[model samples]
Target: MRAAALKWVLWDVKDTLLKVRFSVGEQYCREAERMGLSLNPVAVNSAFRQAYKSYSSRYPNYGIGQGLNGHSWWTAVVKDTFSLCGVQDSALLQTLSNSLYHNFCNAQNWEVFNDSKKVLEGCSSLGLKLGVVSNFDNRLETILKSCDLLSHFSFLITSEQAGVAKPSLLIFEQALQKCGVSAAQVAHVGDHYINDYLSSRTLGIHGFLLDRDNKYDRSEVVPKGHRLNSLEELPSRLQQPMD
Candidate 1:
């Protein structure tokens, strides 16, 4: 009933641990300029969202279920994003897609939250194990390594590796097996409600929904313990009960 002493803290990558320093539009426009093309960042960004959504809906989980790897899946999204912006050059789009894909592997494009490292350290100091459970590609390991955060985690279970994405209980089940821990012994923190919170909570893991922008109103419920405003609150929160 006391939740197995919360042996492990599973983290979500994007928006939870770190974020891209620039918007997709900015990254796109900058890459275009490097290739001697001119484009509006706003237009490019809007196109990226549309292309990403369409691709995700059709090919979901980088199309791992459809014989497509992360590289090919993302290349399609990038190529189509530029195509939607009217680039109309096949070779240029392909080259740009390749550039963008590899560029994201290193830490230069990402900024780890100010509180991320401290929380990770605090969790370790608490004698709790750490790991990552994200809906990311295999590039996740490289990305975290480049950021120097990979050493903190005991293991990383990416959706690309799990053959399923979050919001589905299968991914979390895989994570549980990897940690060799029961659902009651883990806590999962992520930004999305359905994918990160509800899904993990459904499996009896302590799911902490991170609402950094105050997007979800506190009056909605017992926000004091149910949701987290920052990673800084996690160490203490873990000391409390799930309810």
Candidate 2:
């Protein structure tokens, strides 16, 4: 029998191996009903998402100027979103923001991708070392364990734990060190172009983009790595040599 030649495979969790359902808006709306706010949960969810994006993008500039970390930035965004939704209770909004930590930890509503377990199992059978590098809070390990996928990974690196987020080479270097593989022998699979593709390429490690949104089809941003639509396509993609 031939042994697997690949040294390591690194994966991203959210929107890559798992489908995250944001239920905080629904919970907030339900609580709002008790407080007589009467806002639609869907609208709240959309507004929250937009606010989050705006805040996240602005943070590197405005946040550092204000000396805020990632958690503080997101908390402010959540409070702003709730305020925009006509939520007037300061205490309730604080509780809602705190609730995110609980939701992420439990993740009872989040689901592993349909092909995630199968793909990981296949990789294990092939004797490939597996790891995860994610931009998440402290609950990433609990989330993966809840889905029964933790055992497949030899290393799990989260931005919260690493004190650095994706699109940063430091976190990627940490994953490589833990897996004991050179950049050339490692493949990093993730769903975001900037975080997953550009960052890995900067370090000379192979990067694969999971473009489920088809947003890149019209863009001229040719990735330095393979592009795949699903986790099921990973094994075949990995089997091919790097170009």
Q: Highest lDDT among the candidates is held by which one?
A: 1
Worst 10 residues of 1 by lDDT: 217-226
> Model 2: which ten-residue window has the lowest total lDDT?
216-225
Q: What is the lDDT of residue 225 in candidate 1?
A: 85
List lDDT for all candidates, in order.
0.91, 0.77
Question: What tens digits encode model 1's per-residue C-alpha lDDT throughout 1-243?
Answer: 344678999999999999999999999898999999999999999999999999999999999999998999999999999999889889999999999999999798999999999999999999999989999999999999999999999999999999999989999999899889889999999998889988988998888889999887665424368688899998998888766
**Deviating ranges (above 4 Å) for candidate 2:** 1-4, 22-24, 31-37, 58-74, 218-225
Count the clashes in each prediction.
0, 0
Which residue pairs overlap in candidate 1's backbone? Answer: none
TM for every model, in the order presented, reads 0.96, 0.82
- Which residue runs does candidate 1 get wrong by more than 4 Å? 1-3, 219-223
